[model samples]
Target: MSGIRAVADGLVDELKRSLPQQRKTQRGNLALLVATMLEVRSANLMDLAASLPREADRTDMRYQWIARTLSNTLIDPDAVMAPFAAEVLERAAADPDGIVLILDQSKLSDRHQVLMLAVRHGERALPLAWRVEATAGAIGFATQKELLGVVAPWVPAGAAVCLMGDRFYGTADLIALCQRRGWDYRLRLKGTLTVRDSSGRTTTAARAKSKDFYLEDVELTARRAKTNIGIIHDPGHAQPWIIAMSDNPGYGTTLAYSERWGIEPMFSDFKSRGFGIDNTQLRYPDRLARLILVMALALYSAVSTGHWDEVHHPTPAEKNI
Candidate 1:
């Protein structure tokens, strides 16, 4: 237990050192924040406080302070994200497979939808940035575009970037957005959608079915905007799956599309598997957004620690940072 505290304290100190000097007043609250996260191993403020050990000097402190500190922390989300962004960028630059960006939305009840952007590493998608919108159901085109736009500047110039998402995200506007950003994207398409084939013949995607096929220089229309699309059909035991992309369709596209599931574990980590974020009672978007930054830090810390330990123990290839 002492060793864990020492490690958590060290992590808190590391986070403190990374902050701007002007934010000196936040150091203590930041320490409490990190230590609580490490102690509870959860992102919920109430849970974190419940797990905290009683300090010797702070006799008047209450568990409620943990929630207050989290809510009122002086740190800007961008400032908190800078080091993480740098780390992911570094990894992306070194990856021969290049960077794969996964965009997805996670919903809580019908009130909050967090549009998340994460970079794929092995089977896990480590979150890079996200935007919280109050509406429910599926996220809109404008919101999706806005989130991707936030991620675009971080990607290195001329580096391979592939955006993967479900059928709801594979809209013509998003495909065009990826094209404008000069990045590759693969999005699952509805089986019933109309797509023009290579020979300039229009047909429903369901009619173009084969065991596996890649058709290049196709066209897909959404919201009356027609854009060049590539379609890939790979039916491997599951129902026939169709994907639309700006790049030419091939086995590579299908394989890349398979990696879209990597982001699922991340959502699980944020909810049932790790932080219990779905159980959080807080309903305000801004406060929830602040909480997410803290959750991101906890995630980054756990993954980084696990990765360092893996260097010594050499475990099986599971999700590490």
Candidate 2:
């Protein structure tokens, strides 16, 4: 076990330990090489091999050997990374403020891509989950559901939970699901959709007229927002109206949905310089997850060491769990 083989071996074992069920890939090498290359920000196999230790540099012995070991063997990366999500998110949920679960997806290359990652906000990228978004397209529901299940336990019993998401998630099903589970949700709804009230009554007064009827209009600047009546006459059928589903209603109810954007800068950091998530060349989803896991581990190290905020020189920053 030379090259990154030992380090790879340890990582594989660590990942397995975090899993609920036993994993089969114990002596991984090529998989390890792939993970390393992806993390090194390099493209192509030859360049990846360059990072291999000289002692284990044999194309067949180290890299190929590791690959042959995993060939045809089946193991979902989600199953492996699930525990890590539970470990990290559960901690966030335990915080006094509780964790702000930001739901968003990051696209890799659109040209024949595989995985879509949902990462936590802040200078540190606490990965929530990775899914095979190429097959599902845009936002992945199955992956998000599985990830939420994993993190649910980490949230203390009766802790205040706030889930933030984008307009892609503006659906009655998701909203009802979160409410049924007793989690406080902040989701951005597309103004075009018609809203149905709980009284078993529906009205299209907003839809038959204004395009942005049922949706609320809020303009935010820096730290504050100004509320106003929105006239969405640009698109299809809709009526101008404002809407919100709060524990109790008031001003800024709909405006609070914008809080999820705070996580947007974090996504930029991962794709731009921190990790090569958006620029991945890996063909397999499992490999993609592995690469992301390593980068997330690096991010976790930064968050633990207070490196992300200090390195980037933020005015005031909070430590990410």
**Best model number under lDDT:** 1
Off by over 4 Å in 2: 1-47, 58-76, 111-125, 140-143, 196-245, 251-253, 269-272, 307-321
RMSD of each: 4.0, 8.1
| Weakest 10 consecutive residues of candidate 2 by summed lDDT | 220-229
Candidate 2: tens digits of C-alpha lDDT, residues 127-183:
565554444455556656766776666555776777767766545555655767877
Residue lDDT tens for model 1, 77-121: 655676776677668767887898898889854688888888897
Residue pairs that clash (backbone atoms under 3 angstroms), model 1: none
**How many clashing pairs per prediction, in order?**
0, 7
**Cα lDDT, model 1, residue 59:** 27
TM-score of 1: 0.84
Q: Name the lDDT of candidate 2.
A: 0.52
For each candidate, the alpha-carbon lDDT, in order, equals 0.71, 0.52
